[model samples]
Target: MIATPQSCQELLAHMVGFDTVVAYHSGVAEAERKLSDYLAGLATAWGFTVRELPIEGACGNLLIEHCIDPTLPWLMFDSHMDTVGVEGMTIDPFGGEIRDGRLYGRGACDTKGTGAAMLWALREYAAGSQKPRNIAVLFSVGEEHVQTGARAFVEQHLALLDWTPAGVVAGEPTQMQVLGATGGFVRWKMTTLGQACHSSKPDRGHNAIYDMARLVTALEDDYIGKIRATHPLVGNASAAITVINGGKQVNVVPAEATITFDRRLVPGEDGQRELNAVQALAAQVAASRPGMQVTHHQFESAPPMGTVDGGQFANQAVTALEGVGISSEVAGEPFTTNGNHFAAAGIPTIVVGPGDIAQAHTPDEWVSLEELDRGIAGYAAIMKS
Candidate 1:
């Protein structure tokens, strides 16, 4: 079930071989389990207490604990094990080919590659005699879909892992930069109902689609102002109606219409506030037409958090980066992550990892070999303090 560091890399290649792209409604299985087993075995080899967090029957988070003197607080570095869907790629999607100083495949950048880096770091620290503090490494799942994996892990095991020493580095694509701020994520669906009628009786039926289009136009303009009023980081809180499908084949006067929203609220803005504003907009549109009803529902949500420029926990890692050749600066982003959940739960969390976000989820997604080395060294330095 376990292997040497040299073999660990090969094991990781096998882990990535399974297409573990988590769909919120779907789940992770073989690949994620192998990943958990690999970490669990390594943790056991290194004298750690291992706990498995499962997602829809699969190992979600493998909490590996290495304790020495509990006198000092512990350090935790967390990364997800799931990858986004493989949409486009030129080579073998699961090949794990390491050519030209880069690893090419689906999970290479978005996650599994980072998982390999963390495993390599664990091997490095486990072999060293630095007498590192109680280091807890968490490899979480479902980060590509919902925050379910980490959210569940925190709810079930945060009390055990919650130690107050350094900080929690949420390993993600940062191109080796430490992230300070993260965007909020939310999704809503709006529907309009109308009385069904024959195609020839169109005049008699209040077409739901025509009514929904009116609401969509209103949503894209005036209602978004509520979000724009409190924009930060990259830009204003953004919203787009990504999906709209109604009715059967076009012969009849369709009785129903619906639109799905993709909204990105910036950090510092309460997630509930955006929901309320969108609801208000729906109410306003519904009031205009009493016969055709309008309703909205929230499908997904993640809170936003600002960056910490100079906190003891935040600065420790920043300070460590400077020890190497890397200079540090705080950054705020318009993307959401489990960091939102960690920060919401009162843990100081920041984003850090190798590779570029631009390459994430793309076909043939890859990370430079140099970034992997950098990520390993940088992660090792963070726990060194």
Candidate 2:
């Protein structure tokens, strides 16, 4: 059997070697399977019981448990296995090369760095004589795209567990700081339909592109501008039209046009309510313009995370960072993480890890060794607490 990783850096290198970008579009499935196998081996060697919870075909979530007593409150450390697609990357996506105290790879900074740290902390806890609490490490898949892995774990595995966790620390790039809250998101597509005709006879057909332009303007001026309330940490709720597609040809009047919108929700904001408001606006716009049909399809609505447990876990996390000599303040993230799903499951969740968010999903993604070492220490401290 392959030996367990001796250190956090070694484990991170092994994790970066896997090209576990999501399947279908990327068509690569071996990376997640291989990484799961590696983690299972290490968990088995460390005297932990490992369970592979099946997600979509061939993709699964790995849960490693080190339980000293059933009565003790369990603490869960979560991180995703999949990384964003490595298209247009400057460095080798799976190279796992270390240079100038930085590790270069796709998942190095975004998540695998924290995954390694979590695993290392678990290993250390298992080897140590004093067991502070029961621990469970979850390495989930499909975090970058749909979050199928995390959702499945919550609905399937977490419900089946005998004990509820005291808290959950989701692994994300936060420069070794604790994230107390984060903005959630709602995304959808709005489409306008009209009749197609020749450019020379443009007056004969209603232009879908023109109809969509009016709809966009209405949303920006009416719906988005009306959001006055703001979360203390994550700032005001915001909306933007991210993608738009229209004309089929230069000479033909387009018969259909579509635009995609992304709306960020602050804590205490209802994502479904916000989406319903948009749909209402779309219907109003369509009714105002004769022959112009506007329709929207809701794709996703992820709830915003809040410090619902009265900040006990946040305080413990802050103390953990301070013990490691890492200067960190409780903060909020503009983007969501797997923690959103966990928080939805009634688990007090926080996002903390190494590296910077700016480097994630970049052309030459990298994480500094200094921050990685600090992350390992911080996670160990948190687990012990």
Candidate 3:
């Protein structure tokens, strides 16, 4: 049913060949479809069931079930099937080239590597080396998009399974560090409305840009401090005015100004509380600047997750990692990832995988040949134990 370590290494190269980038849309998300095809093939070849989750009128998540034995519980090896942009990749993002022992490609380190390792580990379990503890290998989609993949899997597919497994090891690039936390992201757009007037006269009309500018400055000087002053593992929260635009004509004061806000919060900071914080800050700014009405609204919200300790999943993960010759210590990440979705569902989740997160989605993005092997062996130890 399965092969040796070399067989697994070869499979990692194959997965890297498919450009499972974050850019996908419409019915079967081009990238997801490609991944689905590859995964379906693996399912058939490896004797696993292939199930597709129809997200937003399309196949959003791909679940490959490896039921080595029905009597044992499960061990979920989760990896995302989506990547970021491939704007200026020197090597073809989908080349899957293994040069000098390193794989040069887009999603190589970000996740494809983890997926491959998980696959190989499952195969090893199926290989009957020692009748590996019940386990299931999952290749989730849309992890780079909106975390819809993990969310769907946790809600829809978990019930479909006969055994929910001992725990889930979400493979995201931990560089081998056990990740137990993820900072929250709250994105919003603020618009300022004012009466249009001739710029030269300055008396007959209002300047929306000026109003927005005041809000931005106040937010930077005041509100930014209120929210950004602290965090436990991820450091202090942050907010930045990334975009702003308000101009109708050279001589006219624009009647509307818009600004985009990027806010990151530490765990325990409620999403709504963050929104309220913005609203409260805007009210203060408006009070100081007459005719400056700032409206705060949320466009995106990723609830944060805290470091999980004292849980069965955490203990088992620690033991599994230790059994593999690598001990794991619980840690947190400053950025947001799909782990948040499952964490929000009260699932004890950790984001760990190969490759340095620093190289993720970068131009010359690449993963070390050594790390790939460690990831495979480490994951195998987890599933087998």
Candidate 4:
């Protein structure tokens, strides 16, 4: 289990072979559970203590530890096990093909590469000359969707340890940069209700689509421009209409129309307050019309990764990357990560990992083998810190 470049690639290939997409219908996805089993088996064989946490509404998590001394604090690393769906991929999504010095697969770049690198790094650290700190690796699930895995871990499983971790590095596609901040998000759906009738007698029916059009226009014209509150690291908040559905048949006027939007939250802003503002705007739109009826359903509100109590650790992480010949600085990401959960729990959390974020969830996702090797070295150096 020495984490060489070749070994990391081989491990990533095995990881990519499992289709661990979050199954919303069945709660924790079966493939994700299987993948966790596989990693737990490997950790057990390598002399690490493994604990399985079967989450209720998400794919479960694995907490694998190597305790050199029980009295010492721990350094934990987290990387999710689930990936987004692979519907429009151009290449074999699970093939793990190698070409032009890159490894191509669904989760190769987004996160599986980081998990593999971390495992290999831990392998080396356990056998290294200086084992100053106990190490823990959290392979969390449901990161691509609701982030329930990380949330559950912070809320429930963190007490399993004798003391809180000294620092936590949540693995993500950061191009080897240390991330200090990341945006959070809130998603909601709105449905407009109206009377339905045959298209031949359209005058007798009230058009829900027409009402929905007005609401969408109001969101674009009035609401989108107002959420301009900015943070120095993560930048401005954004609102986008991502999904719309209406009409049951061509011959009938639609009775209901639904639209979903995502609102990105910056560091200082509050998710609940912003969601309330959107609801207020939609209520205004409905009030202006004679018979418009609208309903709002808030899906989820997740907080952003703001400055942690242990902010000084970012400097140590940067220095660690520098030691491995990878020039890195403290930066921010527009997208969110599992680090948000740790940061909310008052742990010194930073996001860093192997690949580029641009390749994540793309049709032809990939990770450069050379960068992955460097990632292994960088993680090893961080462990030493």
- Cα RMSD, each candidate: 2.5, 1.5, 3.1, 2.5
Deviation in Å, model 4, residue 385 alpha carbon = 0.9
Candidate 2 lDDT tens digits, 289-334: 9998987775977789898797788888999889879888888977
* Candidate 3 structure quality by residue, lDDT tens digits, 1-385: 3222356557776677766666543223556667667777766776878777566644567777766668866667788877777877887888777788788788788888888877776776777667656666677777775676787777787787666645678887777777777788888899998889788887788888888888888888887866644565667778888998888889997889999998887887887877787888888878988777777664887888775454456556667788877768767777887777777776677778878898898887778778887788778877666
Of the candidates numbered 1 and 4, which has the greater TM-score value? 4
| Model 2: ten consecutive residues of lowest lDDT | 22-31
Candidates ranked, most accurate by TM-score first: 2, 4, 1, 3
Best by TM-score: 2
lDDT of 1 by residue, 131-157 (tens): 558777788877876676778766766
Cα lDDT tens digits, model 4, 1-385, are 5322348789898889888876763344455887788898888888999988777745578988999899888999999988888888999989989899999999999889999999989999998988889999999988887787889988987776566888899999898999989999988899999999999998899999999999999999999976678888788889899999999999999999999989999898888888888899999999999789999885886799987764588888999899879999988877889998899898889999999999999999999999889888998999987
Deviation from truth (RMSD, Å), model 3:
3.1
Clashes of 2: 0
Q: Candidates' TM-scores?
A: 0.91, 0.96, 0.89, 0.93
Error of 3 at 66 (Å): 2.0
For model 2 the TM-score comes to 0.96
Error at 205, model 2, angstroms:
2.5
lDDT for model 2, please.
0.87
